[model samples]
Target: MKVNRFQVNVILGIANGIISALQTLWFIPYIKSFLGNEAYGYVSVINGLVNTLMIISVSVGVMSTRFIVVNLEQGNKKKASHYYSTEFFSLLIIGLLISILGIILSFNLRKVMNISSGYYNDVQILFLMTLFSFLIQLISAPFSASFYVKNSLFITYLIFICDYLSRIMMTIFLFSNGEKVIWSSALATDLVYLGMILIYYIYTRKNLPELILSKSLFKIKYLWDVMRSGLWVGISYAGNVMLSSLTTYFSNIFCGVIITGIYSAIMQLNIIENTVLSVLISSILPKMFKLYSNDDNQSLYNYVIDSMILTTLFIGLISSGIVVYGSDFMSLWMGKEFVKYRLLIVLTVIYLPFTLPSQVINQVFTVKNKVAIPAIATLLFGMLNVFLIIIFTKWLNLGIYGIAISAVIVQVLRDNIFYPLYLKNIINRVKWKLSIPFLIGVVYMALGISICFLVKKVIVPNTILSFSLSVIVSGILLFLLALTLYRKKEHLGG
Candidate 1:
């Protein structure tokens, strides 16, 4: 795999991801001071709904990327170019409709959530941002994929960095002047994102040869082909978004806004752990796509196995630390009062080891155009999330931990069920299982937790330092266990 535009894209991607993560980290103080916990909860719920719609817009782009990649692989630059333009125009139509629908749905979003108090205006403002954000996302997607085909990751990242920086500057500038600014900041961020996207659209138009809008570009045959390939991907993506983000709304409804705000901070920190791990794993897609494009099954197979092992190990150690010392991290990051919600933070921390595999496997099916299997998986996972959340939250009176627990439960189910099924669907030649290595991963988690308890016993004379030390010890043990269990053997390379 030649390092080209795609590698640049990956770098830019990591940069953008880092900036976004840092900006999110910085949001903690703003969240605590600008409004009540309910206000943070209010923003969370609106953000989730916006994400749900954003996922819907994303389905088209995700499919377009897959479709365009195949055309490029078959050496059909003409078809590939046409597909990009056609998809862009199609998204424009859908973008307009989505903006209208989102605007109309804004009132309903607030009504259904039944939010009251100083947040009503904030919620209204959030819905408007959703409308604009959705449009930007949909319109920019195809151009984003043009870079993907050529493997131009850096510029792809620059697009996001520019957008994110604008968002950050707005938030900082507003907050510095002592404004009530969460909603306003979000609005500014989305508008900046819109501007960055338009730049990409214009750039792609000028730079990419053979890109032109034509009546033939919109032919039914091409449209059918793209949709057929992407049919399952679109559905599952929608379900996954709902499942992943719906917890915010649930947290708000069941746990109170303040709790939601704290949970948001914890969740952000948890994602930071994953983001640090993401630095290692983020290169898989472009490289894997190139391997697959060249029909290099051997390298693809090796890359897949190695990726699973690396992701599992990296996330395992970090998750162990979070599950143990997250209270201290939260105390240090947010405040002491927020430490009461330690269980919520630990719940998110415990699950990432298992969760990262499902993410890897999703990319597998995506590149292969076998979207249906994963879509079904997401459906089952979403249903699982809802059912468990309902049973635990309402029937068992579980509170905030219910949402966290439900997430882990659904992730475990998705990893076990959908992964192998998608492998068979995509190639019909690969054999896979969940037997030994995965079980060892489970044991690794158990040991980390068990050791954490023992360390707690020894350090019990001093609670804070004890938990902190236990977390550190868990990290060391995980590193050794990972070395012993997850052997690096140049596994699965094309």
Candidate 2:
């Protein structure tokens, strides 16, 4: 009855995929029907603003997974407890700082986002709700991280499903009857995180007693160490958020909130691509930590390569399918108004194939604790992306497509060109190991592009039917190709 890491990850991945797809299908179209694009745009703006505020908490969670697994693997129970205790207090303080900032921002948010006076109170309540939600997540970072250390992703996914289901149902009910969509959605989300905290607390008390904090919880050295280790990751996390947040903010300031809503919807569709890559990389991450801790470089190298190739191929298949049918698909999913942004979808997906592989490689950096390089790289490139988004959208008048163009250019430079060179210098025998995956990716992408071209030429009439066929067909073909190739070159998975 017990599940291995891969099995759990696949189950979680499929479960999340279904949930996310349903969410995208139900929430956006239903809300847009009544709430209108402008209201949805404001919602997106608030979400981005709050996400930018949560960067430090995200960094702490990432570091918690690393340190918790490291200390636990070493059989140092006290050290593991210290790691948990350190991040626990540190994030609580950060959450307090966020609360003060959130309060101030709530007053200025209407003017800053250029909202009308009618929705001011609604926006304020949503902002405050998001702030509370984020604060709870911050304090509960260690408990959540403990779940990942135990490979309890199924629990995470279960909570995520419940969260989305509740949020979607509430959104439908409220939006249908002319209630505030923003408030309902934000409240549902905050409630889910609170529920996650409660469940994790119960689980820890029952099964993970050693994770409880002790008298050493306030040790200055331990707190300093966790902060020091997580600093670059925090910067890196902030940098990553800056990339997308800057786009949304710049688009809102220059192009208007309507465009922001449309762009956000396009990005939500692309999240399906991200979910696949995330599932694969996250599935192998705990194992990577253990392998690196044992100094099993060969196994670790193999894992990184196989995961990158698999992710690259699968993302390529899905993204390429999107490139072929996204215009009709979005129009059918949302409304005919969304069809105009097909080029935006194309440009957004161009980065998926490349970004997914880079994420896998970034996991290598995290496990080796060589995070500074990628962290610095992400910050520098993020700034570059922001600069380019401003230039293209503001000056050149490229409109919404400008944001997508800027993101792809920066992603190619950072992930494809720079990261490989950085990894070669540090890890031994990585170049040869990376070569196979790299070559395979090149071949698979070429085939994917050709398949996309063929599929695009097909004269399908009904948008929904066409979209369904494209996904089902492409998925089957991609899986079979992977199975055939893996069988022929077994060493690829070694």
Could you say which candidate leads in lDDT? 2
Candidate 2 residues 249-303, lDDT tens each?
7778878878888888888767788878777777778788778888898888778
Best by TM-score: 2
lDDT of 1 by residue, 1-494 (tens): 77655455446666777797767656656666666555666666777877777655566677777777777766878888777767877788878887877878876765557577666776787778766776777787787665655555566556666766676677777777877655765777687776778777777777665566565677666666777766677678767765777888777777766677777777875766566555544467767778888888767766776666666766776676667667776776566886788777778877777767656766877787767767876877787788888899889988888888888888777776667566656665555433333555576677766766676566652345655566666667778877766763333221
TM-score per prediction, in order, is 0.85, 0.94
Query: Per model, how many backbone clashes are there?
Result: 18, 0
